[model samples]
Target: MVQTTPLVDRFGRVATDLRVSLTDRCNLRCSYCMPAEGLAWLPDERVLSDDEVVRLIGIGVSRLGIREVRFTGGEPLVRRGLSGIVARTRALDPGLELSLTTNGLGLVRLAGPLAEAGLDRVNVSLDSIRPETFHRITRRDRLHDVLEGLQAAADAGLGPIKVNAVLLRDVNDDQAAELLAWAVERGYELRFIEQMPLDAQHGWTRESMVTAEETLERLEKEFVLAPAAEPRGSAPAELFTVDGGPATVGVIASVTRPFCGDCDRVRLTADGQVRNCLFAREESDLRAALRSGVPDAEIARRWVSAMAGKRAGHGIDDPTFLQPDRPMSAIGG
Candidate 1:
């Protein structure tokens, strides 16, 4: 049954999407994402099992009025038997719009299988078009593999394929136009994201930050851009199409242009914690309850209770704003 009363928060924003972290482990060490070393991985036992994850997602869909489910990870493809998880989640609600955000390293091999299983679409992290730049940003030489994976995903019919590029000043910022052209040429929607303060190293400063306005100024110099019709609800990206062309670009200006007012995304960590906002300081431990064999209805009620305390905004701009203890990888972004 569709939930009559959705997960509405203090601000009256009803969450229709849930981003679930499949694992807190990843293969790449992006400079902006995590440190080069000295990182500890989550114990295997701490992560949610496929059955547990599916059950939680089902409750969100059937009782909490969640219409879309997005699987994220340090890199979701790293988890074994991922297609099984995807198939199980899809089975819960035939109408659930399921998607994933991946670094694209393993999609070359798993794209077709995952598509066949029931994945609706994919968002690939492609920071740069230049191989050396890609390597420099991600600290990996898997650019070739990622490129091949994009083609494989397209061939497998996993679209509309989106390329998520986190723009950093003097780093990959100069290549913004080139990256968009490359993605447009390949039929991918390229979205340039402003670097936020979610880095595990906590080294994010406004000086190194690349704002959304700067990104648009850079892109508009290369292509004609007019605001495309936005869909109803809280979508992070503001989309634009190239003049006289079908290809488009989007900007996620979370810092400069906050979207928290319309924000409707809630998150579940791989360890079974529920987060109302990505930058929330507080989290509720649902894993403990699940492991204790608590009833599913009670678990669902706990989810609603957790989100009921959703904050007004992430407060990234506040003078006293502090980065959350969990990094984006651990938080399921």
Candidate 2:
């Protein structure tokens, strides 16, 4: 139950969702997210223990009125005892909608167990369908592994599985229909995201990012998209369907069309940092306070304060904006 607690953000807006990063490590280095030089992994000591993670989630669910919990990571499934973590959270509250985002490299091995452990949904990060293009984008030669993982996810009933493809103009813009056709046929939701200014690696230019408008224009030519009415106050993705109820699609136009006004969510990194906005430079370190014997209430107090200071919006609207200093891996996209 939510009790009397109201989840309020910096602007006195109520928050209904929380994104938790399970780890700050990743197996595949997507060119858009990570640089060829690589990122410095957070020290092992800084990562939250399963107990701490559950504790934070409990506070979020109870005091912060968080109805949805999404596990992100360097790759969340890479963490040992992930099934146990998911199981513990499932036992917390039936009303909680628990979801996990992964690179889908190892979903084949863990999807059934995770589903049985009570994960409600799974979102896989897939950019290109071509093995060679996929390898070129993620720098990992495991396209077959990801495909199997997606199938395993569906087979395990950890769906409706969503495929999150970042449509960069030159990279995989041409594959929009290919990605959606497979998902709509199998009844999977596919959401193509406009690459944001989080990490614009390899000469990332505005011209390189395929806008949501372009993607829809291209897809509408093939399968007609009808408005799929969505609940008020949701994530960046705007819902749409393919004429019938068999399959649907969505587009998250963070770059071309920002959704910061109705953004009522916060991201907690694996190292215990709270990022109020993905494109904001401000972040608060909560791990130090959490480990220093701060009670849950006090921890929640600081958390609210940190969230209260969130910017009105990310100013990618500025004509000459540079990408944020931190990589997406650190921010847990």
Candidate 3:
């Protein structure tokens, strides 16, 4: 028999949003995400097969009440089978909301095919518009490629495309307002995310990370922002009207101003490990069960049990907090 229980934790937050990491390999080595050389990539056998990914997503939608599925990656576009994966997941449920979080490098070629295969939207990671600053932050000089990808995605009918940006102190922090202006002019929704302790280098410091207050203060100098009238709900980014109208910007202050109280997300790493929290030190191994020929219902039960132990918060404010071993790229962010 199939399980119908929603993926809920002790905090009573039902996890309807699922973030699935397609692979642990990326094309760029952003200073904040990983080193220039990059970390070791997961072996082919360890990562979930395209079929395995679809099966798990099927269970999440048909049995576990998943409403939205967002495909993430070290860079999701690098996955050879991304379009097929999206197509298969869409076949599971026509109503299932499917999206992707990518670096926007591959979208120039794949965006049309992905949208044809049923991808509803995309969130591209773009830190700076200037080529020099972009290279400094991402260790790459592909800002022009990313810009082309954005336009390609727009031409493919991906409306309200979102750009996820992270500001580094003395790096690209001063470009917050400038990036926002660029996004506004192009009709893309820009979200500024506060740097978290998820870097592979483990160099993230609370003192060095920019805060939401500072981001808002910076934006206010160039644009008038009032809180968007819409309720935040389970979404992480808090939206603000850019100039008191339809145009808006978002700030995902994951570190300083966490929204864990209403978090409704569950993450699956590329290796098929279920992460209940982004900073979780432990993971429930779903790949082992799938490989061992366990029934789908049993796998669903294991997922439920794993989520039940989720902590009230990420505990970044705790005196003895420790960052997880896996970095943001490996953790599917």
Candidate 4:
């Protein structure tokens, strides 16, 4: 059932990357992501098991031409048997590029296991370098723990670890320089992502967002950065580096500079929905197909069809653009 045709959307953008959410549970409650309380966790039966996740990924690789897989969640590290899932998925396609995005709160205990399980790299969510600011943003006092987890990840040979920092105007925005210095000193790549309207509380506003241009302007003050000389490829970030420094930083301008034209990524939520875009208004249910004992080819067909129906773009900038009902955490970011 391996189709010769690639998974190309109507716009002709081919899909090569898949993001799978392991769970919707998180330890820390980031203000920009989730509310302080009142999150209803999905039932156990609704969540996909590790075997199911690995099977879907195998189908994606063997039939849909997917080459890279990233595990995301409320925090991927929160899921039990995560290392085993990584190992199984990697075993499916030895050459597949496998990665994970986590809050790093649990990475201190899981990094080594994950690396041994064949994880390639990681992107950890770290908003601020100051403990007070970190607590204020994440509502957790685990800044020291996160730093330790990052070190553990590095020690486990997770090279080129990226730190994802979401910038909110006047909220931890002034610490961009300090955060960069901290990451550079530790040999970690830092990336600033503009705040999107993905919070569960729907508190996001255009005025509250700190644009990528603004971030670069602030970063340029503390470091001599030049844009990367090579093509950006399909990566969401616009990369830059210090004049002669070892560390590099990236800015993801999802709001300002949409990468929808070249978006190669599709997301599978923990409950089994296939989302063409992060801000998609609709999702195709893959779990139903999986649970119905459908053939792997049929499951792949659902994926292919979903990609075909992908809109020209997410339409985030459109006048009628509506925020998704699913928050960033539930959506696997």
Candidate 5:
């Protein structure tokens, strides 16, 4: 029997996509993701087991109107039973987009099984192609491994592989055009994201970040980019391409051009708390209720109420911005 779910704070927008964070722990101490002191990694017992995650996703798909599920992590590939999890998610026949986002450090080994197990697409977080600058940004030296992993994903037939580049002033910002052109040559959809309020340890300066407008102006100087047919809601990206190419380039202006309105995403941490916003100070715990054996109907009810009660948009753009208590990794970014 097919289960039914009630949609929540999704507003008029259907809640179709679910981003599931497998763990808050990641190997790369990238300046943007965590504190210099590091996250207080969740105890193994506290984390939702693989089985637990699958069950919640089943409920989400069957009831919450979710048709897409993306497995994310501090680095999703780091999880041992990852392929098994992907298999279960695929088994649901959710008729959804099943995708994965990663640092690509470990993608070489994991991409094949994940692809075979029904991962539809993969997005790699690559800030710079330069080995030295890459090391400077991520504090890791696995650029060659990452490149090979991207290629491995393609070879595995995980088509439409994407690269996500975060534009940091004096960092990878200068390479925005270069990266987009490179992605175009290879038929990859490249996305440039403006860095937002991440952990204080990352040393984010509003000054060091580039806005979507700045990126567009710079790119339009050479390439003729017309707007996309339909703008995806609250997504920070200003998507375009090199005139007649199949590949597209996207710019997410979350920091400088906040897309609070029309935002339709709710985040579930690896520990199973639902966050209404990346900048939110509050979250609702569904894991506890599930463990209490509450029926799926009740869970769906809570999901809707929570969704409706959620502020229309995350107030991240408030002049007096308070950083989310949790870091980006914990939030599944």
Candidate 6:
């Protein structure tokens, strides 16, 4: 039987947003996310099958009160069954919000199919507009391909397409204003995310990061910015209107200014573990329970129990805090 009670934590936060990792594999090896050599990919047997993913999503929506679902990955487009997965989820609830986060490598060919399959929009990870800078950051010369993919997504009618960019201290930090100007020109909502400690190399330090304040300062040099009137709600990005108009940019200051108090997200790793926080050290296993043929109600109850243990905050500011073993790639960004 479906549960009417929402997935509420001890801190009174109700999780309505679900982020599902399609796979722990990505094409590009971004410096801040993974080493150029890349980490060992999850074995096929360990990763959740398409059917399993669809079933769990059904449970989350029908029983657990999930309202929005964002498909993420080391790169979601790497997963072959993504379109089918989106289709199945859409069939579950036509009104459910469905989105995807990708590196934009394969979006050129898959964007239209994905949109037809009911993907509402996309958030592409693009660090630089210059080919050389892009290659330097991602260790790949696929900037041209990513740009084409963004255009293809736009042609596919993916409006309000958001671009996620990370700034490395000396690497692309100078391009902050340039990136926002490019995004505004193309009508893409650009979000500058402060580099976090979730890198595979674990080399991330607070000093090396470009804080939200710094990002705003850079943008202010080229454009006028005022906080958008819209309420932030559970959104990670703090929206700011550029030049006081409809075009806007965002800054996700996960380090300097945490938004954990209003977090309403839960993550399911590609291997089927529930992560209550991006920086969480502990994960609740759902893959074993599914493989053992546990009933849907039991699975839902386990998910609720997992949320009940969520801490008040990610504790990144805490002196003794440690980064999770999984990098942003494995953790589904």
Clashes of 6: 0
Taking every candidate in turn, the Cα RMSD to the unseen true structure, in Å, is 1.3, 2.0, 0.9, 1.2, 2.0, 0.8
Worst 10 residues of 1 by lDDT: 1-10
Better of 3 and 5 by TM-score: 3
What shift in Å separates residue 24 of candidate 6 from its native position after superposition? 0.6
Q: Sort the predicted structures by lDDT, highest score first.
A: 3, 6, 1, 4, 2, 5
Candidate 4 global TM-score:
0.98
Off by over 4 Å in 5: 1-3, 200-202, 230-236
Go through the candidates in order and give each one's C-alpha lDDT: 0.89, 0.84, 0.94, 0.89, 0.79, 0.93
Please, what are the lDDT tens digits per residue for candidate 2 over residues 1-333? 344366666666777788889997889988888876578898889898998888888888878778888999879989998999999988888889999999998899999999999999999999888999998888889999999999999999888888999987777888898888888777778989888766635356677678888999988888888887766455778888787755778899987888888887889889888888887687888888888998878878888888888877787778866566777787786
Off by over 4 Å in 6: none
Whichever of 1 and 4 has more lDDT, that candidate is: 1
lDDT of 1 by residue, 1-333 (tens): 344457889778899999999998889999998998736889989999988898888888888889999999989999888999999988888899999999999998999999988999999998997989988988889999999999999999999999999987888889889888888888899998888888899999987799899999999888999788657358899888788567778999888888999988999999999999999999999999998999877888898889999989989889999999988889888
Candidate 4: segments with Cα more than 4 A from true spot: none
Model 6 lDDT-worst window of ten: 1-10
Candidate with the greatest lDDT versus the true structure: 3
Error of 5 at 85 (Å): 0.7
TM-score, cand. 6: 0.99
Q: How many clashes in each candidate?
A: 0, 2, 0, 0, 6, 0
TM-scores for all predictions: 0.97, 0.94, 0.99, 0.98, 0.93, 0.99
lDDT of 4 at 261: 87
Candidate number that wins on lDDT, 1 or 6: 6
- Which ranges in model 3 have alpha carbons more than 4 Å from their true place? 1-3
- Shift in Å, residue 226, candidate 5: 2.6
Candidate 1 lands at a TM-score of 0.97
